[model samples]
Target chain A: MESLFTWNFASEIVLSTFRMATPLLLVALAELYSERAGLVNIGLDGIMSFGALAGFMISYLTGNPFLGILAGALGGVLVNMVYAFCTVTLCAEQTVYGMALNIFAPAISAFIYRVYFGVSSTLAQATLMKTIAIPVLKDIPFIGPLLFNQTPMVYFAYLMVPFTAVFFNRTKAGLSYKSVGEYPKAAETLGINVVRQKYVACIICGLLAGIGGAYLTTCYVNTYSDGIVAGRGFIALSAVIFGHWTGSGVLMACLLFGFCDALQLKLQIISKDTPYQLFQMIPYVCTLAALAIMGAKKAGPKAKGKPYLREER
Target chain B: MKLGGKSENIIIPLIAVILAFLIGGVIIAALGSNPVDAVGYLVQGAFGSKTNIGATLVKVTPLIFTGLCACFAYRCGVFNLGGEGQFIMGAVTAVWVTVSWGLEGPLACAAALLLGAVAGGIWGAIPGILKVFRGLNEMIVSIMLNYVATLFMGWVYTELLRDGSVPQTFPVPDASKLGRLMPGMRATWGLVIAVLIAAGIYYFLFNTSKGFQLRAVGLNATASRYQGFNVKRYMLFSFIVSGAIAGLGGAIELVGTQFRLMSGFALGFGFDGVAIALIAQLNPLATVLVAYFFAVLRTGATTMQVGSGVPTSVIDIIQALVIIFAVAGMAFVRLPGFKQRMLNRQRGKKEE
Candidate 1:
């Protein structure tokens, strides 16, 4: 098996990195729509937390992993619905409401978990999805099985890239959505339902982010743990910004991060260049550096934080 | 633009408090706990018994410091998440200094506080310098620093500062221990010191020329720079002070209450103070009330659990709900009605 080539190592890194980046990619794409319309979904962390809980709970109950992913996505949407209703409809401060939702997330999820599984010292693990290798691709040495083989969720993640790309670039509605993000007043003047478009965008962010959370629980960890979402959502947010709000850009950034995180883990195991925790800090620090660098590079949305009012200046 | 002097701004905050408590009561009831009994236990546990009250005050002492850390940044439109890390580093550095030197009570405390402040100041200055020199955003940098600080503290606990005696550092010598407030409560004079610090910060922030410049820079840094002030330097100094204040909070918690640093010993303490700062709407004086309220909720969660068989998670739920409502600005009434008649009359008298 010629999987030992330097390029093979690099290609293999991208392959597995895709698996790791799937959840963040999905969530970042979700955020791309809402953020474009001047809303920040800081509660994406909470949403992922709740989604992980929901996904795990549903999978444990139904014994079917697909439905679990759906439930997780729905769970994310439910929280985002609260966020959307508060910030978009009730005209609350988006940041505050979003942060509060982040707080509310673990509180609610833990409360419910305690209610259902009271006094249990440990949680029961759920069923994990098996990796399916394509028949012909399975025999192609290192490149074949490695590239073609993965769980259903992994393929779904790849599908989402082109799906979102097409949705954003090729569709008339996508242009209308971008118009709302760019200038809601102008969009409204041209007869687009600016408020509706924003609501749709926020809802989509919620749904996809939930699926992202599900991917973490079912495909990766396969069991729920305290603070299981960890800091992945923040890493994903960094990816989105690094990607410059484009689908390919987000995926590539996430792959870079996944490689950094994975390489850190692997490197710490082999060498004593730095402690594992110190190496772990690299990903977050890189996020900060990337954000600062990008801030100086180019302009993003014209209206990022300003809420558009149909009647007001 | 006048906004009816400074007194009117107080109403929205007052309303936020009343609404938070009333909703908190409902939450307890929904959890199958008697709201009255929950409040009773909270009061009794926190204040009715002298020992518990002292414990509460001791807890509040450090929280007050962290709360002020957040309060300073809000006046400048920046939210700092690195307080937790900064606070822990402050404690570690202070404890290390205390062990290195043998001094009596007040001298050791002062030395520890100063050293801790400088440690926190340096750590906090990283983001500050980045924001000033490299045009970095403080919010992202602060969040990143939080992880770094937390990991650094965790590393200290495990490697450099590990103690075999117990899970924490060795007992600070009697000379290093903060003196008690009175004979009864285990609460130390840290409360008094915290109050003094708060008053000092209040005067510095509300009255001093430096405080005014910081606030001006916070309100609009570019405009302030155009007026020929050292905007970046002031901004950098702002984080140094904020981080120092937060560091002192950690020192107080360790020296006054905990007496040794350990894992999860002060878990969520810094973030709790952040919630208090927000609920207090960046008012240093009001931070006491908000911090106390949260402390009581944390103290009372146990009793609420024992009494009604409700999971203690309900208290967390209530705290989250209160934060949600506060941040959403849901509790604020932009328009004041006849309901605030008594407050209006009191303000009317104050204006004279």
Candidate 2:
């Protein structure tokens, strides 16, 4: 008597889930890349904020969302340079530098919003990233649009997941990067440019994480706000850890968490009497639970916070 | 090379603080603010009157707890990134205790402080235990728990503690509050508590067997394990203790400053504590000086904003810059043959 699959609501949930997962995928993959090289990106969250603001600002100024995305990525790299400076050069606590940068990003952006942008809601009519129809794929009925006919950036991000895995697993430098993470001392003895490799991974993280923030602002929300990044960098960090530093693993974790996030939002509309706050917290709570119950697989970097040094050179 | 240890560590931070402010002065000038007037305003705003000094002291109150929170785990070779969560839970637990029964003066204060630490310790231990038992990462655990604690705190405020008359919790009974220490300022006995906690942590960490175990673990976990020390147990203990210190910090803030539980009462102190701890290089005594300097910058920043056309956010920028400069070259003393390894890595990359 029951219809096999309701066309009305369930599909909408799936679509929203995919949409939500996109940014997380981009950012987590970014983390996977950088962390694999033994350098950590704590300011991924801050980079997201800076990207959102930069993307929104650029889109607003030029009336082009594509340009906005580029601007956003560049902005992220710019902010991350500060992180790279303290973490890589100064040999500071990566997490401490990261947390400070996170706090600093919002404060600076909020001030700029007040000072430069003033109190206007939404860069009102700033360009927004829209789905592009794949000519052949667009005509392939329902599943086509959901899968193929999506924003260019989303497709790019999805492609990046596997692309990154191949890069790390196949490329010569990628092997060196992994070696840098596992045994910096041995890798150094073998004459690998450990610090340079570390910088490369970190800078790439900056760019990809910037795109992730750009996706949130230009694609998902179409504007920026104070809590714009909203712990997504941390979420990306969680996804990377949950997936145990693998490319495909991070994608799966991102989708699962993002699905939970979308599902929690839908749960509130299921009935009137349910305590929505409890449901709202399910995604994060799930992240906490998953982090705890995921077992030995989620162990982190070997020489995580320690700076690589050579003989008293 | 043979300079006294304490003097150099302490003096380096002082110089860094001075240098950071000097840079901040340039930033103020760039923002079109007069440096002298801005400095004057900041000094007056943060410590000018009795009321201002009192507020500065109150603000400095929680920093001491967070300082201990960061320093404790850091000393043990495990970084406790969950200070914010611990602080929040401590404040929340304090509120619940105040509501349930009426305990006055020293007992109420003592109870609140202990419960605060316990709550923080437990919160902190979650990550530490995960790190030790399941082989799960502590950084991820601590990071996620922070959001959980914050949201949970927000929920408790909205659901259970909300006075219904306002968006925040109802005030604690007069007896639950630590009495004010000054006539003109809101500073209370909380400052004294903060001081005592810092001093106690310093004495315990630098002078005791427990401190040596933690330092040994931090210096080399494998070596400590070789020495038959339970690295995991101490990591858990110190992390929990650190969380407790931070938790007690949140309770003090509630009792001394806010007098009621509010969402985000602990604010950015937990994160700021990391900066303080780093600047102090995990030295317990150095934490006091760093906390005070940060407190002055924060308290005076508002005045800087008002007096100069510059935004107070320049303080945050300066804070970041300070961390960059502070941790510089700490790796200078690492390993017996660090340079040879560094050069090899560089050469390997070049050949590839």
Candidate 3:
């Protein structure tokens, strides 16, 4: 046990934690925005799956990872428009429609992928995004290597943390978004276009989730596999609740989830005797525990999961 | 002319199915296949022969159980997304009892199924207890439990209950296996049992006072609480009972069809059940019909793929579209203008 907790091993785990957490952080942030605007988008996993395929295909074709990321985000927005239409414009059940997309998008994505690239023994690879190191910052003692040296996507995810904090707390648009979620009728009466805000929130959520999905294919790994997105999208959903819908809280929650993910992978490698499936269960178990402990008291927006209609008395 | 509530409930989903099929045809055409030929193959595959019908019915059996599971829970306003987890736990427990314990005879089948339901109920109660007592979100907790259950199942098969040479549990005893409706057919009496359960659920939801209170809780929890209904208890009851249904389905699938527990056992059935329940408007009888419809699509998908060279995933796309269109159309029908227009039409007809 003492040998297992060596400095090198601990540092490796921490570094991997950041890498693992990047997608979760991005998707959780995306979910935070949608939920804040009273739109519960459970289709994050589906969007991510589509994004992964789009990102992989585009990067494979264009030989440009950034273009693939862009395509992924745009593809996400395109798919999310269906959700926006059903939930925002039509005022349908948010969870049901979101789940519909969750079922729909993945099938379409797989269909497209199979059409473009026939089944083969060898996995089609994409150009992975290269890690970028800040020059002087990398030379700094402990924190430098821990934080400064990482992929551009990882840096961007962390950068959004503060941006989101300020956007929700300080900005006028953010407050309006919050108002729409809290009380759509009141927000509408106050001259805010509640429908438009909800649409925008869905778009933002889709785009970020797409990027998170793309990161798995184009940045984290160089190839795409079926079910690559797995349940990270759902974990991100949990992170939103576990974080109490705050930006920093979500970051902390995502990091903890990422740690569990990384630890599980490491433990799988370290212990050959124990079934790998037991280790694989760690992240989900932790998420459940965290939600049970932290998600009980604080509730989300008042108008969440309800269809807001302007004409209804 | 104004349509009755019962007819409207049926018509909207019917229209959605037609619309989805039309769109699916267009997609198949774009994929360079003859849409007409694909449809022919789909029909032929699902109902081609006695064997094909039996296979389709076998698929429908579990779907009916899972669909009814979702329908029951949703009727109580509880989203028990843990149906898949409950199903897996049920299968695991049944396999353990049937094979590991070496249970024998007809009693073994009955005992295995009951134990499976109990296991599923316990697995489902976790999220319910948390939601009622601790105010945790049931949906997320239930979904998380799915992953845990799946991993646990994996561990059981690969580590604990693994049989000779393969990573799967031992097959159930021959005597414990469910009897078929017809000789040499794969379809078991499970289909009959599932249909009966659906009828039982329909009666419970529409007939009993307790069921009425459950629906009241689902419709408006606060109002139900005001009316002296224990809303929390209803929600928890829905979760447990719903879970038991799914678990029973899992056991039925195990003994009735899949005698050996393996990887990918009962994957996607839970979500499929959710979609079926929603598409059926949460009506138990309608759930059985919708489950059958989904099974038809699934059973036909392989044939369509083989004949037309289109991927079987096109069926999945079609299924998703049906859910989307049905949900969106139902919402549209519920709009004030539409409802008001129907009322006005009926009133004008009476005056004439």
- Model 1 spans > 4 angstroms off: A1-16, A134-141, A271-275, A292-298, B1-32, B100-106, B165-168, B221-230, B330-352
1 or 2, greater by TM-score: 2
The collision pairs in model 1 are: none
Candidate 2 lDDT tens digits, B134-241? 876676678677777877777777777788866588777787787888677787888887888788888887799988888999899999999999998998888888
lDDT of each: 0.74, 0.78, 0.90
Whose DockQ is greatest here? 3
Per-residue lDDT tens digits for candidate 2, residues A1-313, read 1332478566667777888899999889878877887777777888888888888888888888899899889887787777776676556667767766776666666656655655544455576777887789768777776677678888898899888888788998778888888888888888997888788777888888888888877888776777778678888888988888888889899999888888877777765475566776787778878877877673556876666755433
Worst 10 residues of 2 chain A by lDDT: A1-10
Candidate by candidate, in order, the iRMS in Å equals 3.1, 3.1, 1.1
- What TM-score does chain B of candidate 2 reach? 0.89
Query: Which docking category, incorrect, acceptable, medium or high, applies to candidate 2?
Result: acceptable
> What DockQ would candidate 1 receive versus the native complex?
0.44
* Candidate 2 off by > 4 Å: A1-6, A89-93, A118-125, A139-142, A183-192, A298-306, B1-8, B100-109, B329-352
In model 1, how large is the Cα lDDT of residue A43?
A: 74
**After best superposition, candidate 3 residue A151: deviation in angstroms?**
1.4
Model 1, residue B6: C-alpha shift (Å): 6.1
What lDDT score is found at residue B280 in candidate 3? Answer: 96
